[model samples]
Target: MRILSFNIQNLRLRQGAGQPRLDGARDRDEIGEASALDPADRRLSAALLAEAKADLVLLQEVFDTDTLDWFNTRLLPAAGLPSYPHAHCPPGNDGRGLDLAVLSRQPVQLTSHANVTPSDLGLEAPQPGLPVFRRDCLMVETGGLTVFTCHFKAPYPDPDTAWPVRRAEADATRRIIERHIPAPSQGLWLIAGDLNEPFEPDAEPAIQPLLPPFSTDLMARLPEDERWTYFDSHSGRYGQPDALLASPALAARWPDAIPQVLRAGLAYEATRHRGAHLQGVGRHRPHASDHAGVLLDLPGI
Candidate 1:
């Protein structure tokens, strides 16, 4: 089975207008015309995702259930996908009122849902705040495989102060996943999503280890030349942030379950994401997301 993971930057593209329409006029649920509803951009992202030929999709930064419903109904159908029978989306504090979502062509068993909030996860940062403010995990079972979708906190400009905050959030996520699979023989477990941290292809850090006795980052198994899931629109240089991690047993069973990065949809034409002041409504520009999508192919059992 093929699976795709992406953070669609709330599916709001930057266009002739710098930002999206984040004014108070918009309600709790409104996604269209955030950039004039560029039919081409919307169709292209949806098509690129469908081109993966995936049976499952773990998506983040989607506006809401309504927006996801719209995509599944209109966008994906336009790309020749008449249906996505299974889906799960829990609202998040993306600030702009977006949330994390998942869509699948096959049946999905939502085993668990956890809001990794500061209080819920027992994160100890300081008096002011905890590690992650708005993050959640959607753990589901499908096709004899356990899947978890996460959208980690972004490593903003402040590395010394806020970077570790993001790292702490990731650490909390790691613990949550680990709690589910104490031993390696639990089952086919896979984690995928926009992990804002940079994975040093050569050396895996202890704080964020997703390999060996625990799990292996499927992306690292591919040739270096082909491992990139994101590009800095401002610099035009490519990198890898989105990823997939699974157990050794699962890796052995599906040796060909490679992590493929979809990069065709990472380009900014006219709009720039300078916040609500410079831009208008959204955070990143319209084309795709600040980050590209990463997919994994799990052949049928």
Candidate 2:
């Protein structure tokens, strides 16, 4: 099976359906509910999905289940995608409502650990009294493998302490894995989603806690230039924030399963000014997502 992870960038539609801003939404109260994507964006995203052809997909920055259902069952299908029979998005701690979600071509049992407190996960609050997950770590049980999909805390612009908070969050996540899959060497597990930081030599490198002993950091094997999943709209800088981490058993068995960072949509010019609908989004952003999709092909159980 091929698994993919993408941070779809706040799946809220533009206001007034095409108003282009948060205030343009049909229901002003739905400000944070709808996706910011226009029809063009949806089509662009669909193309990426079709290109990926993943058996299961882990998503981050989703608004609500209804929106995801609509996209999976309706929007994407209209844009030419086979229906994903199973789609789920449980409410999480993200105040912005950009939660973790999943899409699977196969059946998946859903489990929610959104209520798991910081202390229970061996974490102290960043503010001394707060939830650790910037968004929840959703677990998807696909018979053969248990996939923990997460959107960890983002490093904040203020105070600069979010880096430490993110580290603690990593500890908490590692603990969850240890507790759930006690015998890591024998279990089929994967940690997938937008971890919100990078291991670039120049960066703070906060994600190492989740690697090696706990799981394999698939991105580490890629060349530095191909490691980025996110491209900044303002600065045009590239950084890797999304990852697909495999457990020791899974990684060892599929050591040659290469990881890929698909940036076709972001680099639409490669198609000789084609894909007008997807590429016409304008001066600000690319069509699919700020974060490229990361994928891995796994051995079937």
Candidate 3:
């Protein structure tokens, strides 16, 4: 089975102009020009999903269950997933009304849904009511394979602040996994999503601790030269933040299902605005997403 993970940038109805102002270098640029050439930005995002041909898809930055159902019924059919009878979408803390959703054509058996709470991560303070801090996890089973769909907190530039928050979130994920599959030697357990931590093994102390029980990073399993899952649209640097962590038993069983980070979506160059250019660079619009899709192929055990 082929699984794909993509952080569709909140799946917002509106298309942004140019690049984000966070880069600080483009202060003079209004960034407003990144609006879609066509009115249907959602249609464009849906079209990209169709092209991915993924058997299981973990989509970040979604709205809610209703929107997910609509996308599954209306948009994905064109992408070869005409019917995904199983879907899980939980509301999240993206200020822009975005959330997380998973779509699977592979007859998923609904097992459980765990809300990654601040308390679960050892945070002593009472949780805030804000939806942005809410992270969700869905445990699913299909033909003996266990799949975990997860999305973590976004890491801002302030490492001092963002690091602790994301680390807690990562810890919460580890707790959830431990709660469900104690001894990973049991069966195929996959934790797949936009973990938001850099691919480097020793990048963060918070994220590093989970590596033991979580099996191996799919990207790390590949050769040193071939491991990147995302791109920094603002920085123009290639990186990998999304990840797939599989249990050792699962990896041993479906060795051929080794992770395959799909790069077809990243091959796209920015689409320039019609009849207008920004400082020798095209005004952006109609691109797939800031991050490309990462995939894993798991054969039936």
Report the number of the highest-TM-score candidate.
2
For all candidates in order, the CA lDDT equals: 0.63, 0.71, 0.60
Badly placed stretches (over 4 Å) of model 1 are 12-37, 111-114, 117-133, 184-186, 198-213, 268-290
Q: Please, what's the RMSD in Å of model 3?
A: 7.0
Write model 1 residue lDDT over 1-301, tens digit each, in one string. 8888887765532323663321211222444535343554566567667667678888877766666776777777877776688766767656664567878888887743344554555556553243354556678677888887777665555534545655665666666666777774456888788766643432444236454556777888888867766656455556666768887778888877678666555554323321121112123334545455687777774
What tens-digit string does per-residue lDDT give for candidate 3 at 1-301? 7788887765533223852211111111434544333323445456557766777788877766766776677656754557588887755555455567778877776543344455544544335322214456667677677777667665655555666666666666666666777776565788777777743433445466456545766677787546666656565566667777788787777666656654443423422112222122222344445565777777654
RMSD in Å for all candidates: 7.4, 4.8, 7.0
Clashes of each: 12, 11, 8
Which digits, one per residue and each the tens of the lDDT, describe model 2 over residues 119-220? 777666645345666678777988689998888776546325667767766777877877888887678898888887843422545666787766888787
TM-score of each: 0.77, 0.84, 0.76
Candidate 2's displacement at residue 273, Å, is 14
What is the Cα-based lDDT of residue 211 in candidate 2? 72
- Which runs in model 3 stand beyond 4 Å of their true positions? 13-31, 38-44, 79-81, 109-133, 199-205, 267-284
Cα error, residue 164 of model 3, in Å, equals 1.2
